[model samples]
Target: MGKLIISVNTKEMILKSYEMGADEVVISLNQCSFNGLKKISLEELDSNIPVSIFFNCCIFPEQIDEYHSLFEKIQSLKIQSIYFQDPIIILWAREFNCLEKCIYRPETLVTNQMDANWWYSRGLKSVSISPLITLEETLHMIRNVPNSECVIHGHLMMSYSKRYLVSAFTNHNDLPSLRNNYDLTIQEEKRDGHMPIYEDENGTLIYTDFVLESFNELPILMKKGISRVFVNGEFLKDEELLDALSIYKQIMEEKDVQNQIVSFFEKYKETSYSKGYYEEKTIQ
Candidate 1:
C-alpha cells in the first residue's frame, strides 16, 4: 500500500499526525502556496515525521529572487520532497543539485501518461496525477510513471485565475471586499450548490462544490501501486481531520474496511462528498 500523506499547518498538527500514524506530512510555506491552507515559516518545520514542502503557487518574475533565496534556505532542512507548480523551481532544484527531491504537482495539467512519463524521465521522484482525470486515466499514469501521487480526499481545486475575480465582482457591485475571506462561496446561475471561492495574494481559486472522498476506490488505488495518497486538510477543522485520518488509517490497515468505510460515510453524512471525476468520462 502507498503511504498516507496529510497536509498540516502547525508543528502541533505535525506531531499529532505522526502519532496518528501518518506516513508523511506536507506543509505549505507561508506566501508560497495558492491553496488556502494555513502556512508556516521555515523555522517551525522541525519534526520527526518525514516532511514534504508544498510550494505549488504560480510565480511572478519579480518574486523569483525572493523565492530563490527561500528555496536555498529550505535546502538545509531534511525535506523528503518538494511538491511544485512552477517549472522554474525545477531549474532551481537542478542548480542546487537536488532535482530528485522534486515532485511536479500542477493541479490539472498532468492528466495524460505521456506528460506524466515525460516529467518522471526528467528525474523528478514523482508527479501528482491530476485529480480531475477519470479513474482509468489515473490508472494508466500509475502503470506508466515510475512514481505517482493522487489526492484521495479533499476539496479539489477546480480553477485558479490570476485575476481577482471575487474582488472584482464585489467591488463592481459596490459591496465590501471579500478577498481572503475563507467563508465566501459562489454559485453558477444554473448550479444548485455553492462552490467555495477565495482570493489570496497570488490570485483567485474556485474549488469543487463537494469534498471528494475515495473510500470506495482506495482499494483499487492501493492495488495499482500508487506512490502516495494525499489527504488535504484545507477548510477542515482539526477534529474533523483527525476523525478522517483515523478512519483512513483503519481502512488502510485492513481492519474490516467495509465497516470502516461505512462508518466514515456515516460520520461525515452532513458534509457533501462525491467521487469527483473518478468515474466520469469526458467527451473525446
Candidate 2:
C-alpha cells in the first residue's frame, strides 16, 4: 500500500489532515508566519505519525546566515525529511549535516528521469515526478528508477517567475496611483475555485491557479509504482480535503482491480477540474 502526504501551513490544518487519513503531514515553513512557526515548535510533532518540514529552496539559499537558525530548529524538531525544489538547498542540507534527511525534488522536473537519477546519485532519497507527465512517462520512470521514491499527488505548481505583472499594471502612467497603496490584489472569480494569490515584497499581487483535483488518476499512478502521494492542504478546504481522502481511502480499501478502475474514473468525472499553466503552450 502507498502513503498519503499532506502539506499544510497551520496546526489547525495539520490536525485536519490527520482526521482525513493522511499517513504523514509536511509543514511548509516558508509560508508560515513567525507566530505560526513558534506554535508548530511548541506543538507535539513527534507523535505516532511522521511530521516533516518542507523548506523552500528559493527562500533558503546557502548565502543567508539566518538559515542556520532555521536548520537548527528543524533538527531540534527531529524532522526526518526536508522537501526542496533547488539543488542549492542540498548544500544547506549537507551543511546542517542532514544529507540523509533531505529529499531533493524540483516541482517542474518530476517527469525527467535523468534529473531524478542525478538527484538520487547526489544523495536525494525522493524526487517529485512532474504532475504533467503522461502515464507512459510515469511508467518509464518507475521502470528506470526502481529504487527512487516519487510524489504521486500534490498541487502542480504551474508557473514560478520573478516578474510581477500586477505591479506594472497598477503603476501605469495613465492613472493617478496612490503613493502608499502599491499593493495589488489579484483574484480569479471562476467557479472552479482553485486560485492562489501571492504578495511580493513590494506588496504586488500575483495570481496562480494550480488545479490538483486528480483523484481519478490514483490507479494509474499506483500502477507506475508510486508509493507516496502528496496533497497541498494549503489551498484545500475541509470538505475538499475529506473528499480527496475519502477517494484515496476508497482506492486503498478496494481489492478488485476492475472495481478500482471504475471507481476512480467515476470520481474523476465528478470532481471539478482545471489545467492551470500547462493548459497553454505560451507563457503568460
Q: Tell how far residue 236 is off in model 1, in angstroms.
A: 2.0
Local error of candidate 2 at residue 79 (angstroms): 1.2
The per-model lDDT (C-alpha) reads 0.83, 0.56
User: Model 1 off-target regions past 4 Å?
Assistant: 47-49
Top-lDDT candidate index? 1
The TM-scores, one per candidate, come to 0.93, 0.71
TM-score for predicted model 1 compared with the true structure: 0.93
Q: Report lDDT (Cα) of residue 168, candidate 1.
A: 90
Record all residue pairs in model 1 with backbone atoms less than 3 Å apart, i.e. clashing: none
Deviation from native of the Cα of residue 140 in model 1, angstroms: 2.0
- Total backbone collisions, model 2: 4
Clashing residue pairs in candidate 2 are 110-129, 110-130, 111-130, 153-230
Once model 1 is optimally superposed onto the true structure by TM-score, how far is the C-alpha of residue 272 displaced, in angstroms? 0.8
What's the true lDDT of residue 77 in model 1?
A: 82
